[model samples]
Target: MSQSFTTKRYRRYTEEALKDALSAVGNGMGLREAAPVFRLPRSTVLRHVEDTTQ
Candidate 1:
Protein backbone atom coordinates (compact mmCIF):
# COMPACT_ATOMS: atom_id res chain seq x y z
CA MET A 1 0.00 0.00 0.00
CA SER A 2 1.22 3.45 -0.84
CA GLN A 3 0.35 6.50 1.19
CA SER A 4 0.35 10.05 -0.01
CA PHE A 5 1.27 12.93 2.19
CA THR A 6 0.03 16.46 1.70
CA THR A 7 2.03 19.52 2.49
CA LYS A 8 0.48 22.68 3.83
CA ARG A 9 1.12 25.76 1.75
CA TYR A 10 1.60 29.17 3.26
CA ARG A 11 1.08 32.50 1.58
CA ARG A 12 4.20 34.53 0.80
CA TYR A 13 4.21 38.10 2.02
CA THR A 14 6.82 40.83 2.18
CA GLU A 15 7.94 42.34 5.47
CA GLU A 16 6.54 45.69 4.36
CA ALA A 17 3.13 44.15 3.80
CA LEU A 18 3.14 42.67 7.27
CA LYS A 19 4.12 45.99 8.77
CA ASP A 20 1.31 47.66 6.87
CA ALA A 21 -1.21 45.11 8.08
CA LEU A 22 -0.18 45.51 11.69
CA SER A 23 -0.19 49.27 11.30
CA ALA A 24 -3.72 49.19 9.95
CA VAL A 25 -4.86 47.10 12.88
CA GLY A 26 -3.21 49.52 15.27
CA ASN A 27 -4.97 52.36 13.49
CA GLY A 28 -8.42 50.91 14.26
CA MET A 29 -8.85 48.56 11.32
CA GLY A 30 -10.44 45.15 11.96
CA LEU A 31 -8.32 42.04 11.54
CA ARG A 32 -10.65 40.73 8.82
CA GLU A 33 -10.41 44.01 7.01
CA ALA A 34 -6.65 44.36 7.25
CA ALA A 35 -5.95 40.80 6.18
CA PRO A 36 -7.45 41.16 2.71
CA VAL A 37 -6.25 44.69 2.21
CA PHE A 38 -2.68 43.69 2.97
CA ARG A 39 -2.86 40.32 1.24
CA LEU A 40 -1.98 38.52 4.45
CA PRO A 41 -3.69 35.75 6.38
CA ARG A 42 -5.97 36.84 9.21
CA SER A 43 -4.38 34.34 11.59
CA THR A 44 -0.92 35.71 10.81
CA VAL A 45 -2.01 39.25 11.50
CA LEU A 46 -3.79 38.19 14.67
CA ARG A 47 -0.70 36.42 15.97
CA HIS A 48 1.51 39.49 15.44
CA VAL A 49 -1.05 41.76 17.04
CA GLU A 50 -1.33 39.52 20.06
CA ASP A 51 2.43 39.30 20.37
CA THR A 52 2.89 43.08 20.34
CA THR A 53 0.19 43.63 22.92
CA GLN A 54 1.89 41.24 25.31
Candidate 2:
Protein backbone atom coordinates (compact mmCIF):
# COMPACT_ATOMS: atom_id res chain seq x y z
CA MET A 1 0.00 0.00 0.00
CA SER A 2 1.02 3.59 -0.57
CA GLN A 3 0.01 6.86 1.00
CA SER A 4 -0.16 10.27 -0.59
CA PHE A 5 -0.59 13.79 0.71
CA THR A 6 -1.51 17.13 -0.79
CA THR A 7 -0.87 20.67 0.27
CA LYS A 8 -2.38 24.02 -0.64
CA ARG A 9 -0.32 27.09 -1.30
CA TYR A 10 -1.16 30.77 -1.58
CA ARG A 11 -0.21 32.78 -4.59
CA ARG A 12 1.44 36.04 -3.57
CA TYR A 13 -0.37 39.34 -4.13
CA THR A 14 2.11 42.04 -5.08
CA GLU A 15 2.42 45.17 -2.96
CA GLU A 16 1.53 47.43 -5.88
CA ALA A 17 -1.53 45.37 -6.66
CA LEU A 18 -2.44 45.35 -2.99
CA LYS A 19 -2.27 49.12 -2.95
CA ASP A 20 -4.49 49.31 -5.99
CA ALA A 21 -6.97 46.95 -4.35
CA LEU A 22 -7.01 49.03 -1.20
CA SER A 23 -7.65 52.12 -3.24
CA ALA A 24 -10.65 50.43 -4.76
CA VAL A 25 -11.94 49.56 -1.33
CA GLY A 26 -11.37 53.07 -0.03
CA ASN A 27 -13.42 54.38 -2.93
CA GLY A 28 -16.47 52.67 -1.37
CA MET A 29 -16.52 49.02 -2.27
CA GLY A 30 -17.14 45.95 -0.10
CA LEU A 31 -14.22 43.62 0.69
CA ARG A 32 -16.14 40.56 -0.48
CA GLU A 33 -16.88 42.22 -3.79
CA ALA A 34 -13.34 43.50 -4.13
CA ALA A 35 -11.61 40.18 -3.44
CA PRO A 36 -12.25 38.54 -6.79
CA VAL A 37 -11.76 41.79 -8.62
CA PHE A 38 -8.28 42.07 -7.15
CA ARG A 39 -7.61 38.33 -7.15
CA LEU A 40 -7.06 38.42 -3.39
CA PRO A 41 -8.80 37.38 -0.20
CA ARG A 42 -10.92 39.98 1.52
CA SER A 43 -8.72 39.64 4.60
CA THR A 44 -5.57 40.22 2.55
CA VAL A 45 -7.07 43.31 1.02
CA LEU A 46 -8.03 44.61 4.43
CA ARG A 47 -4.55 43.82 5.78
CA HIS A 48 -2.84 45.81 3.08
CA VAL A 49 -5.17 48.72 3.64
CA GLU A 50 -4.33 48.77 7.34
CA ASP A 51 -0.61 48.21 6.80
CA THR A 52 -0.01 50.97 4.25
CA THR A 53 -2.31 53.54 5.79
CA GLN A 54 -0.70 53.20 9.20
Q: Which candidate's lDDT is highest?
A: 1
Candidate 1 lDDT by residue in tens digits, 1-54: 988999999899999999999999999999999999999999999999999999
Question: Tens-digit lDDT track for model 2 on 1-54?
Answer: 887877989888777777777888899988888888888888888777788779
Q: After superposing candidate 2, which stretches have Cα over 4 Å from the reference?
A: 1-3, 50-54
Residue 50 miss distance in model 2 (angstroms): 4.3
Residue pairs in candidate 1 whose N, alpha carbon or C atoms collide under 3 angstroms: none
> Lowest-lDDT window of 10 residues in candidate 2?
12-21
TM-score for all models, in order of appearance: 0.86, 0.67
Question: What's the CA error at residue 46 for candidate 2, in Å?
Answer: 2.4
Best by TM-score: 1
